[model samples]
Target chain A: MPKLDFDTINLGHGSGGKLTNQLLDSGVFSVLKNDLLDQRHDGAILELSGKTAFTTDSFVISPVFFPGGDIGELAVNGTVNDLAMCGAIPRYLSLAFILEEGLPMTEFWDILVSIRNACAAAGVSVVTGDTKVVERGKGDKVFVNTTGVGTVHPKAEIDIRRIMPGDKIIVSGQLAAHGMAIMSVREGLEFESQIVSDTQPLNHLVKDLLDEFGNNIKLLRDPTRGGVGTALNEMARDRDLGVHLEQRALPIDPQVAGACELLGLDPLYVANEGLFLAVVSGAAAGAMVGAMQRTDTGRHARIIGEFTDQHPKKVVMTSGIGGQRIVNMLIGEQLPRIC
Target chain B: MPKLDFDTINLGHGSGGKLTNQLLDSGVFSVLKNDLLDQRHDGAILELSGKTAFTTDSFVISPVFFPGGDIGELAVNGTVNDLAMCGAIPRYLSLAFILEEGLPMTEFWDILVSIRNACAAAGVSVVTGDTKVVERGKGDKVFVNTTGVGTVHPKAEIDIRRIMPGDKIIVSGQLAAHGMAIMSVREGLEFESQIVSDTQPLNHLVKDLLDEFGNNIKLLRDPTRGGVGTALNEMARDRDLGVHLEQRALPIDPQVAGACELLGLDPLYVANEGLFLAVVSGAAAGAMVGAMQRTDTGRHARIIGEFTDQHPKKVVMTSGIGGQRIVNMLIGEQLPRIC
Candidate 1:
């Protein structure tokens, strides 16, 4: 990290004056240096063609720093994952920050480094961005917003319309790890082991899947703030189809499950960051799962459910105790700033 | 405007759950209805080709509502202007919001309407976005981030390398109107007439200029946060060139000038919302000024200065009273959250 002369950021750092330039020069620009961003122009110019995917997300994750990742990593991975879910190759990102005055410069530098590292991990560039500061009491520590653009895969045909009743639903990996991690910190709860946020960029794995499956990969979504239950419920409602799940097949870390159980929260309604749900053709399901298991991030991938014509527009889960129940959309916030 | 069931937004609205969907259905989606955003997908897919400009900005302007504009409009126009300055025809925008819990629904709705109106005026679409609500005191009322993408104008060649010593510098309309307007509200000062913010979209006027002047327009920039003084100083430093200005030629609304004088602020150091400084080829400067004067937003446009090699990397202005002084970049916070 570049040594900053100031101990903390003040309103002057956002004044778009001498202080602002100093902040950018020794801080942001020095770390995230690239030809495009280094130009210091109003925006970055890129050569693009074909179908492009555009998306934006603001990260206000509380605690800023969690076990496995910080808000910087989540900000990059979240937007990159969104483009990946659209079957796009994550290319470039625009990162804007809203910093509260009086935030320690050390904390800000750490976040900038994390952003640079995350961008490298995702193989994307921070092309253009803005910085604004509010009075100390007017804002929390910091908030980051990332907007991403990527080109769609040539062979990918990811759409809800492609999902049929016979399509198989697959979970990429363990669930409830991200939400449980934040909850654990917020509630000061502990288990036998530490629960870490599963915040990782899924672009590489998504590209691999799209290259192999092409049109067979019907839809892809990461269970974020609303979790897997909300994602699945929305899919069912939109497609006018039902989803059938086997509780035994839902892969989750034992610690995360325990934490959720202890808190009376269902694992299915808990958020997952690095994980994703893929809807695939029934014939390709088995092969897809096998392929996913060979990848590092998807070692725990499994087929947890299937789309059905029965009980249209609903999600039915068969529990380990042999009882079935309907899974509805989450009505209220389970945890604020869960990311 | 669509009537909402809730009087104020809560954490649930940002939960990505039932309440979140309801908020979107009744608020965002309803006001900014478009086919791309209505898909409710992870991102919007656009068929874009050739050279594109990308930029992002976060607006944390206090007093969400101001004379002649609001934060929403500023959010949209700010990004749109950034793209315009890059010599691109603004195309699509990604809107993201960080709202505080307990914010009145009416305020949020009015902002949404302003955003919609601004988008229409700029001829851009809000394709994808995200909203995250923080705890009541974790954030101020609201913060907005807009990321915009636009196709570069084929005829334009905007670059500092293209600027020469004899290039003419032009200012579009009055200076310090925006900063003074916000200050008037904050200081509770009354002017002979209302000091309204000169906040409006400049993409149309920019398009017209690019279409006509092409490469003759060496560079374009909006004198926003740091005002014209800071922008020119940066330009001079970047190109290792000097800028010579005639104060008699600087345009300013009389009331705005008086307000700045009373506040002990220099008009050159104040912010502007709907003004720009263009560096054009001296041979085409006269024609460009004539053309700009015919446009609605540029009626007061005039040649204010010229690039020179006399004092390299310096900006010197000659006053109407015949005294000369150096103009430097703004050093400290003039007005925080002035947008």
Candidate 2:
């Protein structure tokens, strides 16, 4: 066997192939030496003395910072909501920062403040962090990778596997608000009404759902960069289920709808910051909708869809005029740096 | 009260003045929210249920990476030894990465691998991490900030304040080897002999010391960025004591001396990655020196200096001809990035 070179790394290292694994095994795993890392699973199976939920996310947003949140807060809240979606109480966060030098101290400070504020609002402590600053012109502003650990409630058993064909999908708020907000700022597009980024911390609203529907809440996900449509598509594929969303039933602010139309973007595919998609048993769907509407962040909550075993691994939408279409994962970057 | 501008950070933020305190309270402390951070002390006071040791350091090395270790591994081991200096069993680490993006993944991976390997060699786990990637053209390669935690045996208590005037100061292995290696690589200076980085994990040798002399050891420190001279100065300043070094007693590798002479750099201010200064009580100094010499990493361990109450806060070095001179901290970046 040839001796591995330790001088430089190439793009092939991130290709998830033999070299990637070799890099992880020889370089990363060798140093990280932990049982959890050794598992090499899609997600780590952490054993907790108390009930807990595990969540992981990869952040590759361009331009890192924008009007609302930068990659810092996005990395923090993105995983925080994943745990919250599982009805878990978020408590600890592990942060990883990849930086390119020549970046200004002012911009770094701004992002750091945002991350700190987000953790405080969510009542989670940033127990650990890693920073690596690289040479100039070699990286984008910054890329943050975060993993969250939260304690799950013993009685809360929300799972997508429980969704039946007649299950109802309640969107916690308006569609296209976050996506349009980013587009407006990035493209310098103006509207009759100024659009503000709908970025927010959602742990409080999650607690409300746990208090109301408990286990009947089958699933929850904050529709972010890929939008509500991609989120529904993931849920359908994960459980070998299908989803039918009603376009007319979806609530979209008139301004956001106009902005999407002007930009030739689909409201479903445009990102949302403060919105969550909830799948509930048909019996508890109405009560869940009622509970969500009571919160200020969820006043626009609506029953936008239903699950079906008929069209497996698909998300079909019933248009306002009765037309039908399939919703899929984003092919490339859309409205880059909306986070 | 005036509304603060959110544009850029000024030097005052790091000055440890009013602005620095405000930045800490409003930005950093607000996000961290921990008791240890709230104490507002030069060093955090951690209450150990069992036995433990405390260590603190401020890292501001330029270029961050050179021939030997980068800021990442340097940050890890620097504090790791601070604990080892106290006979503490290092077990956990907390890392903070301040990044300026546009940094190549290649450099990031190299440093990351170094950090991973260093932690493994030290028998420590990085339990928590924080990362912030700044904008392009704003930061140098990268700067890593690290804090470490370790456990000590119940019977161990190594105190620098207990050092008597006649105590022996031992230099572990060769002086200025790491610094010279960095300069050779950075300046592209080649010699008949290759000057390999003297960066080696020293926890194992520390273990040997504990096994041999235990609490009789007064203090230990890896002469890193500022070399042995600055480390001794800091000890003198902190303990309000004088340190006297005999020129003939100091150990310097022939190659290191040649490299320093070629580069016009002082060996006293040059960095040492694998060397440490140990202040020991007279009774056990001989046994400790014997134990250090027996180890592979410390074969050249020799008595270099003594402590005294005279000439307070001064580091006096006696010349080979019996003359003396003062050694002080390097005023600015020397052999930049020679970590």
Return the top candidate by TM-score.
Answer: 1
Q: What is the DockQ of candidate 2?
A: 0.02
For each prediction, how big is the interface RMSD? 0.6, 17.2
- Where in model 2 is the C-alpha error above 4 Å? A1-66, A69-120, A124-182, A204-253, A266-292, A297-318, A321-324, A335-339, B1-182, B199-252, B267-293, B297-325, B335-339
Q: Write the per-residue lDDT of candidate 2 for residues B80-130, one digit (tens) a residue.
A: 776676567775555545445445545655666677778777877554444
lDDT of 2: 0.65
True contacts kept of each: 0.89, 0.00
Task: Check candidate 1 and list the clashing pairs.
Answer: none
DockQ, all candidates in order: 0.91, 0.02
Q: Relative to the true structure, how large is the alpha-carbon lDDT of every model?
A: 0.92, 0.65
RMSD of 2: 15.0
lDDT of 2 by residue, A1-339 (tens): 123454334332322223334444453223223333321211122223354444444354554665566766777787677678767777666555555554554565566677777877787755444344444454566656555666775556776677789999999888877667667877898777777667676777888778777888877777775678767877887789899889899998898888888888888878776778888899999988887888897889999999998799999988879999987755444554454
Q: For candidate 1, lDDT tens digit of each residue in A1-339? A: 677788888999898888888887775456887878853589999999999999999999989999899999999999999999999999999998899999998888889899999999999999888889999988889999999999999988988988999999999999999999999999998777889999999999999999998999999999998899999999999999999999999998888888888999988888889999999999999999999999999999999999999999999999999899999999899999887
